[model samples]
Structure formats: structure tokens, C-alpha cells
Target: MFRFFIIAAEIIILIIVLRSSFVQYLFEDIQNSVSDWLVSVATLPEREELRSLKDKINIRLSPLKPYQQNYVEQITADSASVKRFYHTYCENDDINPNFTGTKRAQLCLIIKQSPVMQVAKRD
Candidate 1:
């Protein structure tokens, strides 16, 4: 009889604790932490060669502004986009006034010289 009362009291206390804001917040925090950990574990790590290539490119591009760096990255990602954009805009320079022909050519040259692009060509 005494053990039953003790178990019932514990259960009641547990219910009250669960309803508290601190407990709810703690549960949410733990859940988010576990979710993040699982994602990191499931995601494959970056290859060392690619990482090195990216690092080298980053160093070379350190002098460039953020938007210019984006241009270089885009050129490496899809060289065809430049050609399409050129053909689409070259007819009317006012249509796309952002990246001029000379600037695009410079970015292409930098991308061509990057180790990342060279490695990509091998495969």
C-alpha cells in the first residue's frame, strides 16, 4: 500500500515537471542537438583534394570583392552560363549591365587557371 502511494506521487510529480517551461525548453534543445548531430554523421565529409583546391582558390581570390568572387565561382560551376548570358545580352548592352565583357573574360581566365578546374578536367 505504501509503495503504491510512493509510485503515484512520483507519477504526479513527473506530470507537473513535464508541464513546466524549463523542461519543455530543455527537451526542445536536446531534440535539436540530436537532429544536428545525426545530420552531420550521415553527411559525407569533403574530399581532401577538393578541400585543398578550394582552399587554394580562396587564397587566390582573397583580393576579390564578394560579388566578384561569386562570378568566379559561377564560371567554374557552369562555363556555359556565361556564353548563354553573353549571347542573350551582348546584342543589347543595356539589358544586362552588371558584368561587362572584359570582366567576364578576366573571371574566366582566373577560373581556367584555378587548380579546382584543372582537377575537374582530369575526371
Candidate 2:
């Protein structure tokens, strides 16, 4: 009986591990597809607004000293306005509407990692 229970537990653990891996792969595939779609859709005029906002923010804030620029970048990158714009326009509405603090932090990280922003800062 104990051996049977141990075997059952091992099988359950294996199933859990496989299920998690599958979920991870599924999510990654969906993300990649959405990213491709977003890039294509971003060529449209409506999406141009987001790009323009980024440009404007970069222009408005780039002239500051390095530390000030970092401060402004951090603030603008994580601001509610940016989050709203991304959620309202960039993301699919079918997903969760609530942008949690972690999601906002991820947005900030993306902004900070953007090569376009880096180039803009240089010029």
C-alpha cells in the first residue's frame, strides 16, 4: 500500500511538471504571436499615437542631467497614463482588465530596456 501511494505521488508530480511545461510553452507561443500581431498593427495611425507619446516624452525629458533624465524616464515609463494607453490600445481586451503592480513594473522594465529610447537619449 505504501509503495502504491509512493508510485501514485510520483505520477502526480510528473503530471504536474508536464502540465506546467505545457502551459509555459503555450503562453510563450501566444505571446510571440501577439507580439508579431502588435508589430504589424502598430504601423496603423492609431498605434502611431503611442510611438509619438514615447517620442514626446523622450524629447521633453532627454535634455535633463543624467540623474534627472533617469528620474523622469522612470516616472514616465511607469505613469498611469502610459499604463492606460497600453492597456486600452496595445493589449487585447479579452484578457484581465486590471493592470497589477507587477504588470506596471514590467512595463517600466520594457521602457528602460528599449533600444529606441536609448538611441533617442544619445541624440
Candidate 3:
């Protein structure tokens, strides 16, 4: 019984002393290292966004040339783009029924992440 008490008291005192010593920092370091070793914190990789071509047409009266309109149409034919743009200006079928080709190209330029912008940048 006396030996058990002595051991328990020694353990309590040792813990109290260690809490006051630099060993506490060492223990924290070991804990952090073990935590790092046991599990990696997941994170997404960094990325740069591609800059899209300007929407500003030099022409004052003319619409997009057929090739450019075709390019925009080809790029936007993608399901992802339709899903994206449907929520955007394409949803404005109410507005576009009367507006012309220039207005549609302008909408393509508006969505920065669209593949149309990226493909135009490539071309």
C-alpha cells in the first residue's frame, strides 16, 4: 500500500514538473509530428484562371462573323457550358428572341470560366 502511494505521488509530481518544464514543448512537438504522420490534411491545388478574349467588338453595326459565331457555338455546345450558361444569360431567351448575334457573343464573353474563352485564348 505504501509503495503504491509512493509511485502514484511520484507520477503526479513528475507530471506537474514536466508541465512546468521545456519538456512540455518537446511533448507538444512530438504530438504535432505524430499527428502529421498519422493524417494528411487534404487541400486543393492552386490554379490560375485563363483570361478570356475581350467582348468589345470594333464593329459598330455588324454582328459576329459566321466563323466566330460558329467558334462560340462549338465551344458552348458542351453540356457543362450549357449547364453553366443556362443559369446565366442564356436563360434570358426572353431577351434574346429579339436581340442579334452580337448580343449572344457578348454573353459568351461574360462567363469567364467558359471553354469558349479558353479556346479563344488558345486560338
Each model's lDDT comes to: 0.57, 0.55, 0.51
- For each candidate, give its TM-score against the true structure: 0.44, 0.26, 0.28
Residue 48 CA error for candidate 2 (Å)? 5.1
Regions of model 1 farther than 4 Å from truth: 44-53, 56-68, 72-123
Per-residue lDDT tens digits for candidate 1, residues 1-82, read: 9999999999999999999999999999999999999876654232343345345555754566687566545533443443
Q: What residue runs in model 3 are displaced by over 4 Å at the alpha carbon?
A: 38-123
Model 1 pairs whose backbones collide: none
Model 3, 1-123: lDDT tens per residue?
A: 999999999999998889875888898999999888655332111011112222222142246567655544543444445445545546544344433476665554454455444544576
The deviation in Å at residue 25 for candidate 1 is: 1.0
Highest lDDT: which candidate?
Answer: 1
Prediction-by-prediction clash tally: 0, 0, 0
Residue pairs whose backbone atoms clash in candidate 2? none
Over 16-110, each residue of candidate 2 has an lDDT whose tens digit, in order, gives: 98689788899899999999999778656434544554565456434445654454444444335455544443453333333335553454456
In candidate 3, clashing pairs total: 0
lDDT of 1 at 73: 57
Q: Say which prediction, candidate 1 or candidate 3, comes out ahead on lDDT.
A: 1
